[model samples]
Structures are given as C-alpha cells and as structure tokens.
Target chain A: MSLGCELSDLQLDALRELMNIGFGQAAAALSEVIDLRVILTVPKILVLKPEEVPAFIDAEVEMPSSFSMVEQFFFGHFEGTSFLLLPEEEGRKLASLFGAEAAPLPPELETGSLERETVVEIGNIIIGACVGKIAEILKDQVAFQAPRFIEAPVDRSSLERRLAGAKDLALVFKTVFHFERQDVFGFLFLVASEGSLEWMRAAVDEYLGSLA
Target chain B: MGFKVLIVDDSMVARLAIKGIVKDSVDSLAEASSGEAALDLLAGGREPDLVFLDLTMPGMGGIEALKAIRSGHPSVKVAVVTADIQARTLAEVRACGAYEVIRKPADRAAVLALVSRARGEGAAP
Candidate 1:
C-alpha cells in the first residue's frame, strides 16, 4: 500500500483486481460514447495523506484551467472526486464541432439550449462510468448528481480550503485517457473518511478472504 | 435558411456547449461523440454547414476527423472547440483547415458572438 496503512498480500491482490474491473468498465463506456476504441492505461493507484496529494500530478496543473468538469460522488464502499481534464485547445476544437468560428472563452456557453443539455450529458457519462465501475468493484450501489460545469479557472486556494475540511485521508489515482487519436488526460481522487477507512479495512479483509 | 451544424466531442457536456452557442443561428443540430462518429454522421449524408469538434478522445481524435471531413466534405466549415490549447494543437487545427478555435467553458455571450462570426454576421478577426 502506498499509504501508511498496510494490507495483507491477499487483500492487496483482491483490491487490485477489483480496481482493474472498475477501470475496464470505464474504458468501455468511453469507447462507446466516442465511437472509437478507447485505451485506458492501467491506473496508477496510490494511497496518500493529504500532504502528499500535490506530488501525484503535474505541479503546474494545480489550477486546471480550460473547459473541464468536476464531479463528486459517494457509494457505500468509497467516495470519489473525478476531474475530466480537456486540453485548452481541445475545448476550442469542440466548439468548432458546433460551428463556432472564433475561440470561445468561458463566458460564451449561455447562448443555446441544446449546448447546455449536451454539456451536462457528456459530464454525466464520463464521471458516471468511472465511479460506477469502482462501485461495482466494491459491490456497492452508486448514485450521481447532475454535472456541474466549471466555466472558470478553479482557484487553488478555494479547493485547498475545501479539502482541509475533510475528515479522512485521500487517495489519488491518475488515469490517462486517449480518445480518437487525441490525448485527453484526467485525474481521480478517492477520499475516505476516517470511519470509511475503517470500513474499508474490514471490506478488504473480506475480499481477500474470498480470493483465497 | 438557417445553417446546419455538427457537434463532436466525447463529453456530452462539450457537445451541448457547442449546440448552445450555435442554436440561434442554426436550424438543426446533429451530434457525434467522437471523431469516428462525426465522420459517420457525415457519411450518412448529413451535410453540416459548420462543425464543432474536440481534439482529444479515445479513438478517432479531432485531427483524424478534420482530415476525413476535408477529403469527404470539403464544403463544410469546421472549428476546433476544445481545452487543449497548446500551440502545437492550434497549429494542427490550422493545418486541418478548421474555420476557427473556441476555448472551453464557453459563456453565453461568447457562444453567441462566435457563432455570429462563424456565420459571417460578425467580423472573424
């Protein structure tokens, strides 16, 4: 285990297998939506205390600017935060897909009914698939809220302030998504409450038992 | 006649953003979740006056779609609407013959303004 919390060899293997299944499902959903064969590299899973979270990603990516989506969800097994990172150029490219001639700034989305529907839908599918898979792995049911599109650059101070209020350790898993010959990279962090971590330990023990 | 539009992005949200920007100027809206889907929509005989595309996806990405549309539907105007704003990405959009590029998290006014320009209602520069 990357975090100080240790699991038995059997438990670790079981947990890894479960995560693999979840990631696989996410890959399939993405492939279907994009109409292309999406290859999701095996996720790099690690457990980290809050202080170690920054080292997990590109330092400059701290304030992920550009058109992006953030979703937070919780299931019985775990609670997760997912960031769908699109390159700034990719955002412009998407606008062109709808017929825009100039580069659209963050202030430009309020113009149509259909674009609103479409943006929410896209966010739903990507985040839903990723989290749903994790839920399945843990054999827990998952539910989701409507997508909240962040139209502005995220303020790092605000994000840090929110994280500071959390009651448990955070685990960071970075997954790279390559779609339709383009690279769309994203990051996912699973935050476990202190109580949830205790539950996780028991669940891990049970899963490991099943594997053995 | 109002223009016909094509929206391409793996994110349903991005596609919706494009539709929001262009709906006022366009008559009908068609969607493709990926580069291949965009090509498929065109291949099925839908001639879009304009296309909004995302650069990064799982399979057929924006560049490939641009090439396909250029060869297959040369008359269609394509714009790159994505968050990948790296210089190389923009250069690729230029090479692909994209009419323009729009950044992500597009606001209502920007959407309206850009679509107006794409339709030649506003000066593109």
Candidate 2:
C-alpha cells in the first residue's frame, strides 16, 4: 500500500517555498549554536514511492561515514523526521569550536559531554526550523518532542534499513545543510504515509485559503 | 538592576558556554541537568529573573518544563535557548508563552541582548 499522497504542482510549489523558509530558520539556529555562518542549499523536494528512496540515496551522493543524530518530531497536521550528519573529521574541529575538554581522539567514543550537547542542540535547531516553517504554512499548532541525538556512524546500508521500514506509500523530501568552519554537511528528511499525505494536503490547502 | 539566570542543559560544557556569555552582563546564575531538577530548584525557593532552557533533553524536555514553569510561576520570563530553528517548533514554543526564543551556542553579546530584549529592553540585536 502507498504510504503518502503525491503532491500536485501547486502543492509542490507551496511546499517548496515553505520548506525554504523552514530551512532558513534552521540555518539561523545553526549560526547561533555553531557561532559561525551556516548556509543551506535550496531544498530539493521530491514525491516518490517508498521504493524510490534507495535509488535516490545511492545515486545522489555517497553517504558520508560519520556519526549522526537522527531526530523525530510530529506536529499538528504533519510529521517530520530529520537526520543531522556531521563529518567525522569535523568532529575534532567541533570539539574545539564548542570548547569541549576532551582529547582529539576518535569520534566513535571519544566524544565528551560538551560535544554531545553541541550535536543535540544542532539537531534540535534544524528540525525545529523546518517543522516551524511547515506549521506556519499550514496555520496549525503542533507539539514537538525534543531532538534525540544518537552517536553512531551512518552508512548507506543503515540508512537503507531505516527507509525500508517507512510506511507503505511515502512522500520523501530532502534538504542539504552546509556548515562553515568545519565543512559540516547534513540532510533533513520528511516522510509521510499515504493517509498522512492526504491529510497534509488538505491541511495545507486550508492554511493557504485562510491566508488568502 | 542585573538579574539572576538559571540554565538547564545536560551538557556541562554547554552550561559553561552559556555561563561565559551570561557572566559578561549578568552577575548571577545557576545550572541544572534536567527539567525536573530545574523545577526542584524553583520549588526549593530559588527564584531567578530569567531561565535559558534547552528544548531537547533526556527527560522532562523544554516544552514540558515551559508549561510547568509558567503554570507555577507566571511571573518568570523564559528564553528558549536551543539550536532547533524549525518554524513549527518556534510557533509552538511561542504558543507555550515563552518570553523569547534564542538559538543555542549564543555569543556573549547575543546572550546579553536576548535577555535584555526579553526583559523589555530597547530592542534585540
């Protein structure tokens, strides 16, 4: 069964604009936390069946071998799943940037409290911004769970495993985030089941009409 | 007059970073690891002029704490100090009645400015 509804051209345009706003908000949060310029490429939104995700991941870019924090949040009429990928090389720089008192050892286990804090905060900010933009566009209120940071290296296979468990039919959207100073790169994902997608479209339409 | 501030975050390192910024302008502050402990401090009669809250936490996250704090002490002003910049999240925080929303890893100057703004200062930087 399909997990998400496909987006119409107009809905796609609307969602694209809204996603940009959300990304900008996430960038602002990153700037504050990283104490550096945080830039985000224009978000790339795609409506694809769940099966298409593996192809997209394998073809677009090689998944970086680094520790990442995967966060999940749900809001009024929509749900968002976000992944923050930090390059392992940047891990040392991040330790210094956040003034972590730890040996510049390997990131697999050498991370200290401060770096963990930084990671969690960064994850929260981006997720918050993206979700906030969506809510604003939909003109609805939704509660969010604080970001949960997992200190684990993400490989292509692992990501594929996660994607495989997604709802039957799905709407997959992706965005790229580029952090200055340490060359930290990350991506945000939005997955909606088919039923959820229909509800989301109607919710977004209502929001647009209210705005008009 | 300068006011006391309390910061609640799991990372002692984060607490220190925020302390560095807050100390530049504010004279008093305290730190807590979780929302429940922060509330415990307040219940123990420790009152602060401001609270810098981290949204994502292990237990009793920022949202829950915000509701608890507001209902218990409507007078305390809260500035959500987090790195999450999602608009939907901010709208919810605002709806929760936060005094202001400030992003995490804030600089010394920004910290002073945000607190001042929340306290109804001239304007935010």
Candidate 3:
C-alpha cells in the first residue's frame, strides 16, 4: 500500500541500511548489558501518515492482544519514541533475566520500584543506545526521556501523547528482538515524530554520499 | 602559533569524538553544545582558528549559525558536519561560506586533512 511518503528509492535504501546500523548498535549494547548474545532485526520499515498509522499498526504490528511494554522518547536530531512490547510469557522470561517473576498485575509494581527499574533499564539501554549511536553517526545530539512501563490495550491518550500536534510524518520500523535459540515473543518499534521524515531524508542522502 | 579549534555539537560524545579527531593538531580546544552557545563564545572573544559545526541543533541550526558567523566573523573558518547531505543543501552551505562539508561518521584522517587544509601545513601545534 502506498503511504504517501516522499522518500526516493535511493533514500529508502539508505534508510534501510541506517536502520540496520541503528538497531545493530542497540542489539550490541543490549548484549553487553545482559551478558548474552542478543539479536535485533528489522523486518520492515514504513512511513505513514498519522491517519494511516492505526491500520498499519493493526495489520503489521499484530502484537499480542494483551501485553507488557516499555516505551521511551528520544529528542534532538530526530524526535521519536521507541517501544518494546512483549507477550505475557515473553515478558515474564525477560523480567526473569533481571530478577522479576511473572506477575498477575502490571509488569511493574510501582514507578521507581526495583521491578520497574529493571524494565526502565531495558528500555533505556535499547532506546538510548540506538538513538545515541544514530546521533553520534550523524554528529548530532539527541536526548532521551526516562522510560516508562506500559500495559497493552493502551489508552488512546498514551498513544496520542507520543507525537502530539506534530505536523509532519512518521517513520515506523518493526524490529524483531531475541536471544540465541530463545523464542522471545517481543517486538521493538521506532516511531519518529512529525518533521522527522525530512530530517531522515537528508540524513540518508548524506549517508549515501559518504559511502560514495 | 598552535591552532585553536571549537567543536559545536549537542552531544558530548560527538564533541569528544571530534576533539580526538583534531587533537594532534590542536593546541587549544573548546566545545559548545549548541550554535547559540558557539556564537556566545565567539561574542565573548573566544577566537578559534577553525570550528567544526554540527548542522542539526535545537535553537539555531548550523545553517543560520553559519550565515551569522560568515557575515559577522568572516575570518573564522567553519566546517559543516552533519548526516544530512544533498547537492542542493551542500551547495547552500558552501554558499553560506563553509570551508567544506564534512559528512558525518567522519574518520580521523578526514578530520585531520580538513584541519591541515584550514590551518595550513606546519601551522598546527
């Protein structure tokens, strides 16, 4: 389906490579933190109008009906949010990696609690590392907001808060994350704010030039 | 006289990385987190032989900053560094008086080369 994106073919290709680099850096950082070989892969990347985002998410994301998620926003060079969504079982397993048991309630007990801290750490490293690496490569500076734990069946308000009143477009990247031989029911999403598409277009253009 | 250099970027990591890039040739090093800060330093009389200016910033982007600097401080050398490059935009930057456009992910050699070219051979620390 056409999303009305203005990126040229070359720009799109360059963006794919940049996304690979950005996520690859995140995976590497996560691996170091968890002391395991973590693999992060982006299966697809799409730029959609704000109105087109919901349907795209419904069809593409197809995330677990109910789940635990962690999300954080990164600002500066490119404004955007990164989300980590995990199914109940996968959420439990991931928390186990950081010493939290599967819970009947929300993923976190309370903000600032140890369990929540673990989730925050995961979100922080993944989001900060990815955006940080990207900013560094671009020779720009990007600041990250503190991460928060989210529960699925997300409220519309929470969804709208990401790019509230943003006037540009959004680039959505679907990331698949896992450990060696472990079927981790998890997904990673990088959502850029409005006006970011242009910034990204320019970045990809420059990135390609550097390669040339 | 050793070369005095100013690195402008919002990211501390980038400033440090750029500093390392030109460290061997630089006798004086300064950093600014934004274009406005860079200008403030310049206005405050911190004269540098060259400046590595990042394009994407919050308050005043590199383009505007470059324009102001070119008009006000014609003698200072500024290199535009950014991940965004297009023939049109690159031309615009050069037209605004950038010594050169250095694409991001810049290596040490490229940085040193730019510094040497800006400062002239045997002009560095």
Candidate 4:
C-alpha cells in the first residue's frame, strides 16, 4: 500500500501548490486549443506503489471501451514516467471537437488529416504542458520521450506490465477537465525511482527553506 | 534614473507575457531563466531597479532568489509574479525583503502598477 513515500504535511502542501500551477497552466493551454472555457481540477493526489494503479482504476472507472493511453518518459537527474489515461470514446469526442474524424462516420477525417492529428496532438499538449511546467518549476533538465498513444480497451495486466518498476513509486494525480458542459476525466500518473523521490524531497525541502 | 528591470522565469511563455508589459516603461531589460541566473546577473553588475520573479522555477526558485537579491542588493526591489498567488510564501517573500507580489497571467497594467509601487513611482501599495 505504501511505497515509502513519506512526503510530510509541508511537502504535500508544497506539492499541491506546484501541481496547481502546472495543471492550471496546462488547462489554460487546452482551453485555447479547444476554444472553450475549460475548468481543470485536481481532486486527489496519491503517492502509491506501482501495482496499486490497476486496482484503483478498476474500482473507479466503469466503462471498459474508453481506454486510450499515452506514456511519456523523462530522464536525467530523475528517472520516471507520466501516463495520460482516458477513454477512447472520449478521445474521439475530443477529436470531433477539433473538426477531425472521430469514432463514427466522418468520411472527411483521414488518417493524416485533422482528425487523426487531433487524436495524437491532444496528448502532446496535455502531457507536454504539464511536464514542461513541472520541469520549469523544479529547474531540472528533463529529457522526455515522445508520447506513445495506445488505442485499446482498458486492461489491468497490460497496464501493470507497462508501468512496472519494482523500486519506483507512483504519484497518481486525479485530474478532470470540463469544457462547454463536457467532462473529460483522466489521470496524470507519475512514477519515479526511489532515489529520485529522495532527491525530490530534498529539493522541495530546499525550496521551502529558501522561502523561510 | 530610468527603470532597469530584470525578468526571471524559466518559461519563455511567461517571460514573453511579462516583457510585453514592461517594454514601454523599462527601456533597458534583463532576463534570467533560473534564480541563480538572476543572482549571477546581479553579481555580474547588471543592477535592475525592479525584478519580476517567478516562484516555482527549477534552478533557483523565486524565494531563494528573493533572499539572494535582497541580501546582496537590499536597495534593489523585487516583485514576485507567480501563479501560486495564494501560496504561504507570499508572507515570506515580503519578510525576505521583496517589494510586492503579483499574480500570474500578468498583463501590462497589473505589472505596471506593481512595478511602479516597487520603484516608488506610484503612491499606492
């Protein structure tokens, strides 16, 4: 249940502020992209062991057809990955919003056209904006891999395998984005190596110390 | 003396937004991506009348940068420009000798007032 993430009250508080800034910036960028008033909220943040995500997902989300995923890995000074997981049907809805070929019947939405582009690019904006803000705040040079989009049904075992890191701890952020009366629910799941977590803890401590 | 301003933030997005606000008022502008870079500029003899600081930068976050600038250049004024407007560090920034705190998504008018207050250009705090 616990992956030795002993972020204190102060650390958690600091993390909340940091995440707020990062997610807020991302949501603003998304609003511009979708051309709507987008409200982003982080309802929960859980620092958990790697195996816990599947169970958590199984309990929370009911639809099996809505699994769309993208994973971006960042390294250098810290080793970890962040995954954006949502429903494919919802993703198609997002694509449609961008004037692209979404799930059912759009003859004009071609593979290389705006629809497919939107399907791929949404991940880029959401993941890039969030990760970029976090990196900027931390002042760390994080090299990130291209986001790998997986269009498939939500599978527990496969997700666990993809995210498996024996010594790494996960920081699961429950984020919601609502635009024009439509709600898109997703998770920004970050798992960092134990060493990186310790380093991050010290770094946060230094940040607070500077504030004091 | 004319305004010499230093804008510190890792995001070029933020810096660009801040620059638009400061361009007319402060003719000579300086920029630092990290807190350390800002200090280095100050140490290297680029003395700005006001500094627009961001709180959550990676290298030298705004608070430490504020401490450094205030400690070394007590006369120089710093106004924090951050999205974390309600952060507890606001009090600390004031305590550590920052002149004012400005929220993020800064526009020209908002920044202008804060900058003016920082430099004693306007009466209101």
Instruction: List CA RMSD, all candidates.
Output: 17.9, 17.2, 16.3, 12.7
Residue ranges of candidate 3 with Cα displaced over 4 Å: A1-4, A61-64, A100-115, A152-166, B1-125
Between candidates 2 and 3, name the one with more favorable DockQ.
2
Candidate 1 chain B weakest lDDT stretch, 10 residues: B81-90
* Count of residue pairs whose backbone atoms collide, per candidate: 68, 23, 0, 6
lDDT of 1 by residue, A81-184 (tens): 55444434544433333333234545645543334333445556656765665555456676665566654344444345546756556756666655556665
Residue ranges of candidate 2 with Cα displaced over 4 Å: A1-5, A63-67, A86-96, A100-114, A168-171, A180-182, A208-212, B1-125
* Ranking of models by DockQ: 4, 2, 3, 1
Please report how far candidate 3 places residue B44 from its true position, in Å: 67
Q: Taking the true A–B contacts (Cα pairs closer than 8 Å), what share appears in each candidate?
A: 0.00, 0.06, 0.00, 0.04
TM-score of chain A of each: 0.72, 0.76, 0.76, 0.86
TM-score of every candidate: 0.50, 0.53, 0.53, 0.62
Runs off by more than 4 Å, candidate 4 = A100-116, B1-125
Docking class of 3: incorrect
lDDT of 2 at A57: 56
List, residue by residue over A108-143, the lDDT tens digit for candidate 4: 756435434565677677677666666666666677
Q: Write the per-residue lDDT of candidate 2 for residues B4-121, one digit (tens) a residue.
A: 7999875554566577666756758899988999999999988788998877666687889999998898888888877556565687789998988776435566677777775667
Query: For candidate 2 chain B, which ten residues in a row score worst on lDDT?
Result: B9-18
> At residue B11, what lDDT does model 2 achieve?
51
- In Å, residue B76's CA in model 1 sits off its true spot by 51
Q: What stretches of model 1 exceed 4 Å from their correct place?
A: A1-4, A7-16, A59-67, A80-123, B1-125
Best by DockQ: 4
The candidate that wins on TM-score is 4
